[model samples]
Target: MRAKHNVLLVTNDHVSTLTGMADNTITVSALDRTKVKINGQEGVGRDLSLHAVATGKEYVHETSKDDLWFFFDVEVASNPALAGVAGFTTFVMILFIISYWNSAGSSTALVLVALQILCFFCINPYLIALSDWRNFMTEEAEALMHSSVGMNKALKSVLTLIVLLTISIFAFLMLKSVLPDRSIQDMGDWELWVAMLFDSASLTLPFICFGLYTSLPLQVVQILASFPFLFMIFFSTTFSPGAGLEGVKGLRFLFARFYLWCVIPGVMEGMEDCPKDNLTLYTVLSGCLGLFLFLGLQGVLYVVEMNKANAAAADFKALQGSDEFKQLQVEMKYVHTDGTPRGFGQTGVDYKDGYEATATEDSTITVSGGAEPPANEL
Candidate 1:
């Protein structure tokens, strides 16, 4: 976590800005991260080229505006532990599955295979989190950034739902296997499909809240609590037989347990090969459908939201050669607060001449410029 501290101060794909630890206590240098320093400012250039390198570390926070939107802010905030745990688990499971991947008992191979599927689903988010930068993303990038963020949220929500529905269906089959003589086919058109979707959605709340909240034991408890209800759905149907059916026969006819229990897109339907075992095909189809649905909706939303953001984004660029910025060069002795602006004031300051630093009665620092120190020529 400390690896990225004090890294940016501020940056965008086009430029990098370095500030200070207030009152000029520490002299910060960027080296422009380049051997060829421009403008004599060299180490302290106001807007350094992003690709410039210093001290062997890469200076650019991100290479393009697309990355700032497509990956940075939203994904970077996700739990870091996920990558390590997922990687190690996937690695070991993969090795084990490789040994048995082609065996008829390959159903057992589904363990790592399922995890790898989940890992792939997590890939972009993990990369985004890894790409997290400490710099301030420009307001110019905000429109596209915000759009990307919103679209990701909606996408993950839908994806989380799809996977949960698929897994819940599989879990239901496992529950049914517990009974000696139950056949999912006999359940026919259970009015319970609607309930199953909701239950599955509830189970998904943990993943939906992945970065927002994480408590493994609590999550396990929540899932364990659902098992009774899941089992009860089959148990009741087993006893009453006719209870799974209802008088209206409306959506029940439209909703098929076969869709939930079977219907793997690229594989056989109803999982005829292994009715009693978990189907790898189901897991694969679930992940695939989730990706398809997310990409489909995300494409539409990106066009719409990005168009609006792009239109508004033009005005967010830094102003060129304002006279007010010229004055700050001559007569301001200001301090920084960890390289971030303290406040933005709308009016001029009444500082006495020759004062090293002055604060008005309002307690705001009277810097030559407001919170936005006008862009300086390197």
Candidate 2:
């Protein structure tokens, strides 16, 4: 007779199930040097492999969901240290200038308000870019997860929500300081709040319209700059196994299959074109590209305005007070140095001739004196 036994073994790499004859003993090794798995995928693990065979990077490692975010979304906004300083300092200085000037009854406060308004407007186009990119990334993340090769969609959604919330907070605080008392009251109304949503959209028009006014000629230049890079991303993803298996195909196909259905018709309507799918994508890309130009142009203009205001303020301060300038006079008074009555002069004549006569020598003096005494007596 024979007894039966079963064994279950689990390890980091694999699971094993074994059945043996009754009363049989088997030896199993815990750490097997002969076998290893490369990140849950079969094969493709070696210690002493040639450079040519192993030198190339894995597509999964090099081009993936997180890598896309790193390159397209996060890298530009990274270096949080610098970004933090820029955001905080600009916000603080603008707020301080607006508040301090207004409180001190300075007429320049209105200019400060105007600058703040410009800044408020300038940030909108950036917000549009950020929001569109967020939507794009969210879609890509969804595609990856749908293909069952990425992180959970819930995490991505949560992260995107957090990013949007942070942006909203920054924008709110930035614009709040510039609102007048009456504007604050109006903002408290629900109807006004509803109106604000549309108003906000129109506010972004300044950024775009200003750009159109200033740099219409640069339209082609801007599009050309983004074309090659866009081509690379479109080509790489289109040909990629991950993208193909996920059925994204290429940029146009991916848009046609996915985004076109969602955003295209509205874009076409905005462009006042027929609902044909051919022109939909061009309309969408053109709108996005136009927004990029708008941001760059308005950003440059706003900076120039601030610089002009700063220079004018400096010049005003330089000329405000100086000893070389004096008030006008209505009357004049004269003063004398030496107290002379009007203008006067004095003159003196020669010495007195009849006052004294010289005496003669000593010997002749006696006779001469006697004669002079007689003559004087006579």
lDDT of 2 by residue, 186-298 (tens): 33333222222222322333333333233333344334434433543463232232344334343333221122212222222332213344334443443344346667867
- Positional deviation of residue 367's Cα in model 1 after best superposition, in angstroms: 13
Best by TM-score: 1
Q: Candidate 2, overall lDDT?
A: 0.34
Clashes of 1: 3
lDDT of candidate 1 over 51-128, digit per residue (tens): 121113222333446544554345434635444545654564445445533333223223322432343343324322
TM-score of each: 0.26, 0.23
Q: Model 1 clash pairs?
A: 22-336, 33-53, 76-129
State each model's C-alpha RMSD to the native.
17.5, 46.1
Off by over 4 Å in 1: 1-79, 98-102, 105-152, 155-378
